[model samples]
Target: MEPSSILVIYVTRIGDTMLVTPAVRALAQAWPKARIDFFGSRTSAAVFRHLPFVSRVGVLTKKRIRFKGWLQRKSYDLALVYGFDGDGPFVEYALRVSRQVIAFKQRKESLNQKLLASIDKTTIRCSNSVDYLFSLIAPLGIPKAGLHLSYVISESERQWAVARLAALRDGGAGPIVGLQIASFPTKGYRDWPVENFVELCRRIRSEHPKAHFLILGGKREWKRTRALHVSLSGCSTHYAGRLSLRQTAALMGQLDLYIGVDTGPTHIMGALHRPMVALYHPSSPSRALAPLEHPCCHVVDHPLADRGATEHTPMAGITVDAVWEKVRAALSGEFPPPLVTPWTP
Candidate 1:
């Protein structure tokens, strides 16, 4: 089954979108001649840009998918839809645009009958997200290419980030640490305390003396990030609510180290393979979502992670001292070497 053209539809959050990269890479490697186009959420679509394996990237939304591909001929040899929303239009759009479609088993048996393959969600039993997503392409006989998440920053974006960081520092030379203060609204339980962040930053400063901080997040986190910035005085720059997703990622790629909660930017930082200390809530421990094959990954999990902790559990259970030790190790380059398998080009 040599597919000349393929469409991969996955409209989801930034972190979830990042989780799909390995599966996409597997598809690309298995069929090098296939033109693989990705349809992702408006916020997450940009992350697919500059990937060498992807032919194109476009936005996918529930509203816009209503009539898409209805009148068009079957333009793709195959299409794969990634999501559990059986009632959504994503699978319908894929069916219209491709000769063969694959997706998770929908609630409607009729829809399941239409798919080339319907994967049972419960059959997949992987603790790590990268492996979980990579399993989606197994029916195609495509072996896993790599376990690490992939993100590409263009040379221009890198240059722009360098300039922006320099200007923000006003020619100050020091270790620039990026901080993601909070997760999205509903996942607030994953956020380590802001006061804890302040103490961690102070400890980092005391150790390096010349270290500078770049506070990163969305408008929802503005107040918390601002408080931390104020606490750090002249040594920190608050970037919450001020940058685009791509811009945030670009700046993230330039960080000497990144310290963040288990969130989107942490996923982005994971892709960059930079030095990072990610604090995880008990509910969503690092075993399930931490970056695989990361060279300098430092994970600080709540003590109750294995004790059936719930959303009601506070992230404060993970202390600053525990995080500080990981930060110190990351700063001193004391972690083990990255275990990576080279992807086939």
Candidate 2:
């Protein structure tokens, strides 16, 4: 069926929302004239507004009757449910409003297995989130668009970033290195040690002598960012909790290199196609969500990630020295081999 209108749902965080770009692009390319609507949270919807392919971005906060009335008014021809946040009223509403609903099974029970059997079957799986999403939409006959991640930064936003960075630029400051010190609380295991970040910044600057650092994260990370600021002092600019997401992205686009844990901002930086060193722990494997298609996205997984780690893997295993090697390679437009183990350097 050639659907005239389509609705897609994925209310996850920035990283999860960003991974759907290739799939979204695939839909747009396959049906150039189809109006694509995205159902996500405010932040996630904000991310989609930048994509020209998106016609409307809706949030599912209160689920008021008015909201339901408005959504029902749209009379969407088809609904595509993404992996996370695909349950509750949204799913029920998708089933109600759209002619066809395509979603993955949310449970392992017989009921869900049978429910999913009635829909299209997902025949492929991949460690990479981008590919994982493409598989969900494969039944629509949209092939993999490309591995590249995309974001739209407005001109005003670019100006804001330039102005913000200008004040921090010293007469002799070396390259600008962006650092994301913490991850979301629920995924704290993915965070690299703050002391490691402080030490890594010190060591990198020691080599560059006058390098500058920009610390990036959400407001929840103020404590860590504050502590890191105290340690690095004048050498770094703390933007966590201070700027909007797009503004932070705008600033990130101007950075020479980014060093950070596996977090949403890291994904945003990747979509901006900036050079970066993205860290990961066994809590979440790097392959599943590492920056895709970025020319210089270097992922440094904790050594414990591969060595049969069952419990949470600590960030302590990813040494400053090990990450520094990848940082050096990334800054030089090169990449260290697949896994950045301590023995690599």
Candidate 3:
């Protein structure tokens, strides 16, 4: 494979971008010599740093910014874009700049039609967003199974995380468990009750006397994390909203295990191949988002065991007992095989 110039665009939040890694890896493996460039939102750009196959990363700001004119000026050989109608401008950018453009073939909505008109190939019914983009490279004979996930952490980041943990623990424990208690509050039903977490931590400590728990989450989740810590009464250390995204990722890598809701940090842990117990509610697409490529990951689904008349919601039905069972299973080392190879690119 010659080093053809290629541009890949995926503009989504942290978790969505992380999901794209497997597809990225597939392209890189299939075209080892290609100069692969990635474009994503500023927040997601950090996730792509140090990725092996990425020669460069372009940060797309807001929405509808033109990287196409820039890439067109540079004359890249290939361009791939993810997202639906809202992403048409990106497809247009790819079409204008690269010799070949490949995009998802969604409903022939005007936006998709417009994007399709600009691109050379559009794939419909590629359900997995990442897989959809990777399939475009089939013309180059890249095998579908070649896709995998990759994320590189700096040695400094790892050291920084270890030191931070050491400082927090004050040499009390040798290994810590990472716990993230809350997902976004809007989807509050997705959250397992904080009391359940307190109970889980108590049991874990009883089973492994020397092990401590480290709570991680965003600022909005800080209060819940603190409450859980208080309930544990020194059995756990709260580090919620305190670390940068990458730092948190590095911290997660150092932990013996991770327990969290269907959230971004869990997805990051998934990328690192860290063992995890992910809690999911009917609100989340657990089958879609749970760690796909890592073998040591576990998922707990609780679809609101009871619902009153005239009330319906995805996560509101999940129960704590179901979550505990999944967590216990993960601790016992019974985990599912990754649904897909880690996405790399």
Over the stretch 115-165, how does candidate 3's per-residue lDDT look in tens digits?
423333343344344554555555455554443356788899989887877
Candidate 3 yields a Cα-based lDDT of 0.70
Report the number of the highest-TM-score candidate: 1
State the lDDT of candidate 2 residue by residue for 1-345, as single tens digits. 778898888867888888788788878878888998998877888788768888988886535512474445538777887763334455556666677766766543432442322233354545677777776676676555666677889888888888777765757676899888888898887777898888888878777878898888888989989999889988887888998888888988889888888888888877887788888877577877786666677888778775787547678987888998888888678964432111100
Native-vs-model 1 lDDT? Answer: 0.88
Model 1 regions more than 4 Å off: 168-170, 337-345
- Summing lDDT over every window of 10 consecutive residues in candidate 1, give the lowest-scoring window: 336-345
Ranking by lDDT: 1, 2, 3
The deviation in Å at residue 88 for candidate 2 is 3.3
Worst 10 residues of 3 by lDDT: 303-312
Q: What's the TM-score of every candidate structure?
A: 0.96, 0.88, 0.82
Q: Candidate 3, residue 219: CA error in Å? A: 1.9
Instruction: Give the number of colliding residue pairs in candidate 1.
Output: 0
Once fitted onto the true fold, the runs of candidate 2 whose alpha carbons sit more than 4 angstroms away are: 62-67, 70-74, 84-87, 106-124, 336-345
RMSD of each: 2.3, 4.9, 4.4
Candidate 2 whole-model C-alpha lDDT, 0 to 1: 0.75
Instruction: Highest lDDT: give the candidate number.
Output: 1
lDDT of each: 0.88, 0.75, 0.70
